[model samples]
Structures are given as C-alpha cells and as structure tokens.
Target: MKYFIYAVITIVGIAVIAGFFIVGSPGLQRLRRLDETRISDLQSIQSEVIFYWQSKEKLPAKLEDLTDQVRGYKAPSDPETNLSYEYEIKGEKTFALCANFSLSLGPEGNNAAIPIPARGYSKPGFAEVNWNWEHTEGRSCFERTIDADYFPLIKDQKTP
Candidate 1:
C-alpha cells in the first residue's frame, strides 16, 4: 500500500510539471506566430508598394490608398493586434514599414527584418524601432536604400 501511495504521488508531481510545460508551450508558440505575421505583413506592404509604384509613379502618401484606390488590394493589419501598420516616408524612392509603435512587444525595440524574397521589385530591408534623429553610420536613423526602378513610389511631393 505504501508503494502504491508513493507511485501515485510521483505521478501527480510529474503531471503537474507536464501541465506547466504544456501550458507554457503555447504562449511561446503564439509569440513566434505573432512575430512572423508582423514580419510577413510588413513584407506584403512593401511588395504592394512596389506594385503600386510600377503602375504609378510614386508611393501612396498613406497605406489606405491601396485599399481605397489601388486595384485588387487592401492593406492588412497585424492579425494579433488589429492595428494599422506604420510606414515612414524617407524620400521619393525609399520608405520604412513597421507595426504601430504600440504593437511592438520587444524590450529593446528591435523588430525582425522582413525577408526580401527574390520576386518582383521588393528587396529585403530592415528597420530600427525608434525615432532617434542621429546620423549614425551603417545605422540609418531614418533612411533606407531604394534600388529598384519601382522604388520611386515612396517619394514625397516637392513644393515649388
């Protein structure tokens, strides 16, 4: 009887540990899914921008242009947060895309890079998570390289 009791206790303890791990596993997995979705959404926006620029001469001043005016498309927000993504207009040819400031869950504010797939005019690029205006070398404060012919979609209007 004593051996039976000890075995039962061991089983309960093991079950508790297993339960914790099992419950915790999904949280980690959810975070990874969120990150990937955010990255993929950003990449999709970049590709859409490339497509828009190809059909037109400049990038839309805002994201809604895709949903409202552009044909066969609409901008997608993050699935987890349901918030519109943010885009920084750097110049006539380059821009930066990110989740809204509040959507970033990273402690150090470094979001992952959207992989630049070798298709269409969308080249892979990275973004910093802050608004620091410093001109650090190799650490673009708010600048990006726009190399493709479709890059001009992001250009801002110049006043005469």
Candidate 2:
C-alpha cells in the first residue's frame, strides 16, 4: 500500500507539470504568429509606400493614402491590446512604422529587443513614417528597424 501511494503521488506531480506546458504552448505559438503577421503586413505596406513616394516625390501621412491603389487595405493594429499603429516620416526617402505587440511568455524583462527591418504599416498616398510599440512596452515581442537600402536614414523610433 505504501509503495502504491508513492507511485500515485509521483504520477500526479508529473501530470501537473505536463499540463502547464501543454496549456502554455498554444498561447506562445499564437503570439509568435501574431508577430510574424504584423511584420509581413508592415513589409507589404512599406513597398507600396516606397513605390508611391518614388512616383509622387512625396510621402503619405496616413494609411488612407494607399486605400485605392493598395488591395485588401485595412490598417493593422495590435490585436491583443487594441492599439493603433504608429508612423513617422524622416526626410524625403526615409520612414518608420511601429505597433504595440503582445507576448504570451509574459514579461521576460529581456534587455534585448528584436528589430523588424524594412517593415511598416502605411496607407496609400502617405509619406514614409516611423513606428514603435506603445502601451505595453515590456510585453512587446517585436521592434522596428529600417532597411538601409530602403530608408538610408531609418533610425530607432521610441514609443511611449
């Protein structure tokens, strides 16, 4: 009876640990997917803005500028926190884009931040702009970095 009781206790402990990992995995995957999606969307917008600016010699200041020319056009925002995407234009050829992203791993207090290069959200007819995460700063899983080829002066845009 004693041996049986010990075995049962060990099994229960193992099960509990397994359960935590099982439940947490999906959440982490979702966050990663969300980050990737945001990056892709930003990249698409960036290309459109670059083309538009090259032709017009002026950058747009809002997402609406790309609506008529850009298909499936919808401004991307932070899904988890319901925050707006950020934009800032530098000079005539450079811009910045940012978003407040959420992570499932909670705040890792990671001193390092990941940069999303040549990626940003922009509406057609808008100027090149800079973006950065806001609201849940510590919880953000992604950061912004401009591609030197696209925006030679792209610099780190800090979010409030």
Candidate 3:
C-alpha cells in the first residue's frame, strides 16, 4: 500500500512538470506577446512605406521620413527595447525591414506577420505586391521589392 501511494504521487508530479514545459512559463509567454507587438509594428510601417512610395514615386530615404502630421503616420520602434527598427534600401525599389525576434516562427508559417507574399491586392492592371512575413528566433530581416506595376510612378495610373 505504501509503495502504491508513492507511485501515484510520483506520477502526479511528473505530469505537472510536463504541463509547464508544454505550456511554457509566464515569463516566456510575456516575451512571445512582446514579439507579436513587434510584428504588428512592422506591418504598420510596411503599409506606410508602400504608401510613401506610391505617392512620391520613390521610397523614403529613412524611416523618419515616413511620418506626416496630417496623415497621423507615426513609425514604431521595438516593443521591448524601445529602439528604432532597422531599415535599408537594397535598390531603387527593394528594401528590408529588420527586427530581433525572441522565438522562432515554425516553417509552417504559423501566425506569420505577413503570410501573403506577392499577394495580388492591387486593382485591375496591377501585379502582386504583398509578400510573406515569417521569421525564426533571434535577429531576422524581411526583404521586399516594390512592384512597379502594382505601384506605378504616377498615382492612380492604370496599366494599358
């Protein structure tokens, strides 16, 4: 009888330990939430970047240039560190948005920031512009090139 009680107690303890590992600790969960916020901030900035390009027919030289008081456009920085996110123009229309992530988003693309890469969201006579936004743990960057057809130099200009 004594041995049976010990076995049952041991089993219960093991289960509790396993549950913590599966669900993760509270601190870890908090970090994940912060990463999600970072992703959201990046998405908002991306939209503004595209708009800036479309309106000006050129990409902004710096992220700071994205802000407009009338448009209420305010670029966001890192959530945890409260630092500016990394941005660079790779070419005429190509650019990269970078951030440091706490956890790895599986290759399955679960909860991807922008899963729709090259998505066709433009009006008629435009090519796809959106791109997939996925990342792994640690520092990562998402590179995208503006599609000229989708975003012509002239605002509201449709392809023939």
- All candidates in order of TM-score, best leading: 3, 1, 2
What pairs collide in candidate 1?
A: 58-153, 59-153, 92-155
Give a tens-digit lDDT track for model 3, residues 54-142.
88978899999998999888899998898999999999899899999887664753334323233336576555445665688878898
| Per-candidate TM-score against the hidden true structure | 0.54, 0.49, 0.73
Candidate-wise lDDT, in order: 0.56, 0.56, 0.78
**Top-lDDT structure, candidate number:** 3
- Using lDDT as the yardstick, the better of models 1 and 2 is 1
Worst 10 residues of 1 by lDDT: 132-141
Give the Cα error of residue 95 in candidate 2, in Å. 0.8
Alpha carbon lDDT at 65, candidate 3: 99
| Local accuracy of candidate 1 as per-residue lDDT tens digits, 1-160 | 9999999999999998898676545565565466556555766777677666655777778998767453667888867679787777778777777553222333333232222232233333633222222221121223344555424333453336
lDDT ranking of the models: 3, 1, 2
After TM-score superposition, the amount by which residue 139's alpha carbon in candidate 1 deviates from its true location, in angstroms, is 16
Backbone clash count for every predicted candidate, in the order shown: 3, 22, 3
